[model samples]
Each structure stands twice: as structure tokens, then as C-alpha cells.
Target: MTSWILGLTGGIGSGKSAAAAHFSTLGVHTVDADHAARWVVEPGRPALAEIARHFGDEVLQADGQLDRAALRARIFQDPAQRHWLEGLLHPLINQELLANLAGAESPYAILVSPLLIESGQHTMTTRVLVIDAPETVQVQRALQRDQVSEAQIQAILQAQASRDERLRHADDVLTNDRDLNWLQTEVERLHRFYLSLRGGRP
Candidate 1:
């Protein structure tokens, strides 16, 4: 049977996780690309070995895991490095992500990725759902949750598709600049809409 996949995406700190959690509460099977990305870089993974070889051992922590911050800094500063890294990991991550989605038993599945559009993962879905928030809100939220400076956060945003660009690609959009209650309501509404698209009725 064919399952309708929803590509749920948003900029960093745009509350994509929170929106996905609500869908989970409503029984949606959700897969996160970030989790798949990390899985591909586990200590013994071939991808990790290649990354260490190219970027040097400094990109790995003493614990032998990927030093995400250091690696993040390296790739962002060099376009060639960023392109190389994405070329290496995107296939690995996409393979595992598609496998996971195929195994899902739910009537539909949600794939959440910050780079869903940019990484070409959006093509895997029949619908694209974008969780949007103001740039000011994104900056504030990232400052509160991560250790990065405002400048660093700005740099990350620069690397992502512009807010308008993301919206233009979306089949649906949810504004996440408000409180959880408001976000939850939008999620629930979308949840039912997706459920209606399924073969079974709820």
C-alpha cells in the first residue's frame, strides 16, 4: 500500500520538533533527518572515518564521536567543504531515512528535517509542510536553547533557504511564532487533514 509522506520542515529553532511531537500524540509516525544524520556518523561508521580523514582528527572529540560544533564551523566557512560533506552524508542519511519510512505501519508518516528542501528530501514526499517563524523569533529561540552566539545563529540562517523561499516551496505552512497552544491547534488541524487523506477513516 502507498503511504502519504509529509515532509515537515522549518528553520533552526522554528519549533519543528514541537509540531512533530503533537502529531506523534495524534499517532503520526515521525522520522527526523537529524537523527538519521547522526546515525550515519556514529563512531564506527564509514562516513565518520571519511569525515575525519578529510577534515582532520580535530573534528572528532576525545570520546571519538563527531565534534558537531567544530565540524559545523569548518563546513560553513568553506563552501567546498560544505558541498563535500553534504555529498558524502546525504546519500547515507537518505537511504536510512527511506528505509525507516517504509517500515512505518502508520497510515502516513512525517519526515522532519531542517534541510528537507535543500537536501532534496522534499521530493520523497507528496506534501511539504513548513513550520515558519519570524527571523527575530528564530534568533531568540536559538539563543535560549543553544550555546551559539547571535552571530553564529545568523550564519546558520544564512546557509538555509530564505524564509520566503521556503514558504514558496511549501504545500502547507504553520506559523510557529506564537505560544504552544496555538501551534498545537494548527498541528491538530493538519493532523486531521492528513488522516482524511488515508485509506482508513478515523
Candidate 2:
């Protein structure tokens, strides 16, 4: 049977990962775009070749892999460089995401991507689910989890679509302002709704 592909997205530190985890517990197959992007550029992937061409060999470390720290520093220093990197990786990631969704044999598949709304990939899914949190909470969580300063968190958030923008684009919104138990309950409710979308009894 064709699986129902649900696009899961959220702001930075909005607990989208936790929501995806909850879906996994219900036997839903989940494909994370960030993880897929990393995998495609792993050893022996053409994405590495493209990376070398765009950013030069310096982006690769002695072990012949992308130096994430170096690349992050470079991109943050220049908006054009960051856009170039996204242009190269986004298409490849989308291709792989679609492939994984097509190959899924489960009742549904969750495409967990932070940029689902920004990248315009939400159109490929049956529904867009946003794991939302207030900007203050998001900034706080990001600062604590990533060990970055408030200024850094602000810059990151500024680059992303606002919480209001995300809500405007969402078919469903799972607020992550509360605790894990709340997150789990919201995910369960969504899981059941996803099943109903596929004409299955929840």
C-alpha cells in the first residue's frame, strides 16, 4: 500500500525530533531530511564531489570528509556561500526524501525537516505538521542545548521563517511549549489522525 507521507517541521529547538520519536514508537517510518543530507555527502557520495567543486578542497578535512565546523564558520560569514551550499544540497536531499517515502511499506511515513516550509517541500506531503514553540522558549532552548550565546541564537532564528509564518503554513500545529508528556500526547493524536487520513481506523 502507498504510505501517507507527513511532513514534520518546526522552529529551532521546537522539539520536532521528539515528536518524530513519538511517531516511531507507533511504528511509523520516519525519514529525517538533515540526516539524509548528511548521509548523501558521506564517503563515496557524489555530493562530496559537488561540495569540493563549490567550496574547494579546503572544506574537506584530512580524513576526506566535509569539515562541518569549518563549513559552518564559512557559511555564517557569508550569506552567498550559505545559499550556494543550500542550493547544492537541497535538491539532492529532496530526491532522497522522496525515494525513501516511496520505498516505505508502513502505514505512514514522516518527513521530518526543519526547512519543510522554507524549502517548499511541504507540497510533496499529505499534510504539514509544525511542532511549534514560542520564540522566547525557542531561543532559550537553543542557547542551552547548543551552548551558543543569545546573539547567535537570534541570528539563527532571524534566518528562519517566524513562528507566525510557520503556523500560517501548517495544516496542523503541535505546540512544544510544554513537557515531554504533552509532546507525546500531541504526537499520538496526530498519529491517529494520520491513520484516519489513510482510511484506517484509529
Candidate 3:
């Protein structure tokens, strides 16, 4: 089957996860990049070995698992380190993502990646969907959701592509400023549209 893989992404705290969940409820299987990324670096995985080799033993926790908190602090504090880490992980993540896609049994799949655009993974997707909300809402949601300070949230946002950049690459834009009912309605519409695109009934 010609899988209608859609790249689903948004700025931090833009409700992309909520939007992706709604779409999944409508029969679209969602393959989360973050989850796949984590799987690649699991204990004893080849990716984990490579990571340890490159970044040293400090990136691991006392139990020998990936120290995500320590790694995040390191990356956020240094641009070169962040890029180096992405270079190490992105390819492995994409490989596992493609393997997952190959085994998918759904009408379509939603590839939810926070860095879909910046990481250049959108090129593998049939279309791009962006969840959008005002920056104020993003900041508020980030602070509440991640329990981080405004300064830290701003730094994270600064490292990512701007709202305009996301919109510019979007084939579909789901606004998340409203209630779940509105989001469900949009998902229903998209479900039918996606089926129609593949010559199937809703």
C-alpha cells in the first residue's frame, strides 16, 4: 500500500501530542519519533554503545542507563554538543522509524516528531501537519507542562525553528487554542480527507 505518512510537529508545548492522540483515535497509527529515539539508545543497544564511546561514561547513569537529564543539560548548555548529539542519534532514529513504518498495518501513519522540520525528516513524509498556538500559550503550557522557568523555556524555543518557519512548511495546520471538541472535529475531517485521498470511504 502507498502509506500516507504525515509528518506531525509543532513548537514545544503547542499541543502536538494532544493533536496526535486525537488523530490516532481516528484510526491513524501514530509512530512517535521521541519514543523511537529512546528505543534506539536503550541499554545494550548498538546506538547506546556508540553514544558511550563518543560522549564517554558521564552520559550514563549509575545504573548504566542513558542519563537523559544529564545529556539534556549538556546539550542545552552547548550548541556544538547539541548538534553532535543530534548527528549521532538522528540517523539511528530514522532507521528504526522506517522499520516501524514498513511493518505498519494502518491506513496511514502519523510520524510525530518535535524536530521534524529542523532535523530534515519531513522529506520522508507524504505531507506535513503542524499544530499551532500563540507563543504566549506555548510559553504558559511549557512552564506548566515541563515545570521549567520562563528563561529556560525561552532558551529551548530559541534553539528551535520559529512559528513562522513551521507554518511555512506545513501542508496542514491544526490550531490548538480551543477545546478538545474542536480538535476532534478537525481530526474527523482529516480522517475522511485522508481516506478519500487514498480512494477509500470514511
**Judged by TM-score, which candidate is best?**
1
TM-score versus the correct structure, for each prediction: 0.95, 0.92, 0.92
**Can you tell me which runs of candidate 3 are displaced by over 4 Å?**
199-202
* Residues 57-134, model 2: lDDT tens digits: 888999998898778778877889889888888899899988888887778788998888888788878778899998
Candidate 3 lDDT over residue span 1-202, tens digit each: 4366888999998998988898887767788999999998999898888878877899999888999877877889999989988998899999988888777667788899999999998987988889999999999999989987898899889988889999999988988888778877887887778877652322
Can you give the lDDT of residue 115 in candidate 3? 92
Model 3 has an lDDT value of 0.86
> By summed lDDT, which 10 consecutive residues of candidate 2 come out lowest?
193-202
Off by over 4 Å in 1: 198-202
The 10 consecutive residues of candidate 3 with the worst lDDT sum are 193-202
For 1-202, candidate 1 gives per-residue lDDT tens digits of 3377899999989999999999988888899999999999999999999999999999999999999989999988998999999999999999999998998778888899999989999988888899999989999999999978998999999889889888988989998988999999999998878878754232
- 1 against 2, candidate with superior lDDT: 1
Best by lDDT: 1
- Report every candidate's CA lDDT: 0.91, 0.84, 0.86
**Model 2, runs deviating above 4 Å:** 199-202
Error (Å) of candidate 3 at residue 167 is: 1.0
